[model samples]
Target: MLLAYIDEIGQTGAFVSPTHARFSDSPAFGYGGFVIPAEAAREFGAYFNKQKRTLFKNEIPEGTDPNRWEKKGSDLLFARVSDDRPQNLRVFRSLISKLDALNGKLFYYAAEKPCGTPKETNTGPREFEAREENAMRETLNRLARHADSGKQQIMVMMDQINEKSRKQRLPVMYAHILGRATEHEDMRRIVEPPMHIDSSLSANIQFADWVCALVKRSIEYQLVPTSRYSWIPKETQLLRDKEIFTFESKLHLFHRAVDDICHSRILLEYRPVIDPLHTSTMNEENRKNLSESGKLHSVNKLEQPTNHAKAP
Candidate 1:
């Protein structure tokens, strides 16, 4: 069996419209994390803790409380150049190397948040949660495939979310999805429901936070094209070389995967607002086609909206 620790990089709030001021700040949303064999989970956590203590021993204040001893990814990766740049960079690289040697795999799903009115958006009349659910579904599906290939099942643990609705209801939502996934392999490979754990207790979840931060930073660099964060891109290149880091630069196109399997690509769907006249014309054409084929079904059921619809 494998254990996967999942974390999110950006917010999944109900702020899909560009008119919202905060939309500009976080135009993209991401979900990612790392997966390792069950046996390796404990060893990796212990090794990571030891590495942190040894590498940052000098930075720790004398007699500092053990609970306060924390090294966050944001501070380590985005630190100012004057703040132990060489040492911190070395530690970060060493961490990545250790993860690679341990056979940890990284997977993620990211998308540009849908903008415009409900009808104009890729997902008509859907809230931001829908967009997040789509990403989650895709990620879980991939995890299912991975588990099946290894002849093992997977259990997922995510960093705790404080929101009552999200924290309590997300498990139920995932259960419903997995329950209805009769045609997919997720039902078999993903045996256990996703469990939430605090980052302080689960070092694996903390590592996932680091992976998510790195992925989000890489995507942000592409969106803005700035030279200030040169280290991010460099580290991202190393991540791609080491693990199964996957990225979706745009809808319907994927990059940076270990294997570029065409059949595994997620088909992106785009929906434009249809005018009344055009809708009527399409309906008429559909009826004509159905009549020609002696079938009463006028519209394509596959084209109709389903729970699997995702943002473009």
Candidate 2:
């Protein structure tokens, strides 16, 4: 069994942007992917639960009422500081930093459009969308390379997004990549299981809760790193356009909050080789060779075809 832990980074709601009206106004697009071996899945789940407990206690104190917490809107969090924003840029940078720090090979697919693009506008082509699809294909191809030798099974889990437009992108992207995997006979047998968690029931709610707690911690501690701060650049840019200052500061704070949360939760280390026999292609090949050493079959051997003739 293979398990992929997936999460998306972006807003699924409609927002206005000067560049395009219909584009997802979400500032950044990101997905965190991890392929977990079958035997390790349950163990990882338990580990994740433990981590969650620690995070909750650290962020929300033990006696606090968890029911009072609700998912905070990213936009709303930044709104007080800037009518237009710079916070998203900080969040974007932090995400990139976190991705860079991740230890094991992780597959990431992201499409980021400038904020404020309306959902209805029919802009011609989106470069970010193309980039995201390409990334997904490349990642899938890498996985298929290992899978073709019967080394690994593909399993994925991801956070659900709200935009109907973006919802279709993932499966289509997967299909395109899988099409290229046809060259490997073993790759042809790979199957993608239906997505496991329902957004309304379990995973989504849990993710929202996690984000909320993180955000609150950010706000309480003013934990945004100075180096990661968005103001340094925005301060310079604002000299040319004074109007940006008002929104930039607010956006910066909001993003700093997001950065703090993201930095803390990023998965650092994970053991990928769970089942040594299945995970190692070389081992499997050696085992197969040994098993087939004495086997013999006629070159023309074929099972008789089943007969269910019609009255042709």
Runs of candidate 2 with Cα error greater than 4 angstroms are 9-30, 58-128, 146-150, 163-167, 184-190, 193-196, 199-312
Q: What does candidate 1 score in Cα RMSD to the true structure?
A: 13.3
Candidate 1 pairs with clashing backbones:
none
lDDT of 2 by residue, 1-312 (tens): 455554443433332431344542343334434444556555544443443344334455567644333223343234232325444333433322332233212333332333343444333246445645654554445445434434666655555555674566657765764665566554443466225454333323333333332223222222222212223222223221222111101111222212211222111111011111222244656556534642111001111122322101
Write the residue-wise lDDT of candidate 1 on 89-152 in tens digits: 6666677777678776776666655444345554432457676676676666666766776788
Candidate 2 pairs with clashing backbones: 6-157, 16-116, 17-116, 17-117, 21-117, 21-118, 22-118, 82-247, 87-251
Per-prediction TM-score to the true structure, in the order listed: 0.67, 0.40
Q: How accurate is candidate 2 locally (lDDT)?
A: 0.36
Relative to the true structure, candidate 1 reaches a TM of: 0.67
* Candidate 1 deviant stretches above 4 angstroms: 13-25, 58-68, 79-84, 115-126, 166-168, 243-312
The alpha-carbon lDDT assigned to residue 149 of candidate 2 equals: 38
Worst 10 residues of 1 by lDDT: 267-276
